[model samples]
Target: MLGRTMYALISLSDLENDFINPYDLTTRLNRFVAVEYGAQFVLTAALLFTGKWFLGVAQLLLTAFLLHSWSVRQHVVDATDVFRQLPLQKKRRLIMFGAFLFCFVMVTYRLIESIIHGLLTDEGRETAKKLFQDAAASLHHY
Candidate 1:
């Protein structure tokens, strides 16, 4: 369902650009950006929900970077201004970005810690067992 929604969102962008009168460049760009945002947001959430946390976070980073780069290249609007123009209220924007940053930091820290333990520690096996018990439980008995 999430994947379908994402696909639909992406497709909507193409449809809007092609059929919404190509002469209306600003409208096309706005519609594309909004749909792309929704698609990326859905993909990120889907990846995280399916236990692909790293990929999910990477998708989010890609989304941000893509929007910034696209805005710069297209000269449609400043990337910072795009964010500022979100329909969200000030407090909501703060909380939303804050939560995203917190998750990114924690996930990155845990991944680095795991890597360091695997490479440099004698207790790597035990640490892995303890830290990934929930993940392990999802595996098949075979």
Candidate 2:
């Protein structure tokens, strides 16, 4: 469902650029963003409800990723506005750095979240307790 909505939005965007329908274009774009937000919201809710602590962390990181992507898109547009003023090589380098930074942050966030989840969750504590009890019982037998 999300994929189909995204595809339809992309198709409508292409059509808008080829032709001209300012009103419909704006409406379509708004709907697209709303749908994306809805999908994110649903995923987050699922994570919270299912006791999937890792998934919650991942969802938070994904939100950051989306924000970073938005920032990069804005930066690219701003760079284009000063195309003649800025050096082409410098602009290219900045864009590449932005892309790399975005990905790096996303991956780092995921890893950190995963580690934190493993360390802090009740499930981990319960597992540790069971392991300790099992080991103690074995030692007593010996």
Tens digits of per-residue lDDT, candidate 1, 41-140, equal 7877897799977667766775675566566663243333534432322233343345456556866898898787668565767776776896777675
Q: What is the TM-score of each candidate against the true structure?
A: 0.33, 0.35
lDDT of each: 0.53, 0.53
Give the CA lDDT, 0 to 100, for residue 22 in model 1: 31
TM-score of 2: 0.35
Displacement of the residue 15 alpha carbon in candidate 2, Å: 4.4
Show how many residue pairs clash in every candidate, following the order shown. 0, 0
Which ten contiguous residues of candidate 2 have the minimum total lDDT?
Answer: 74-83
What TM-score, to 2 decimals, does candidate 1 have? 0.33
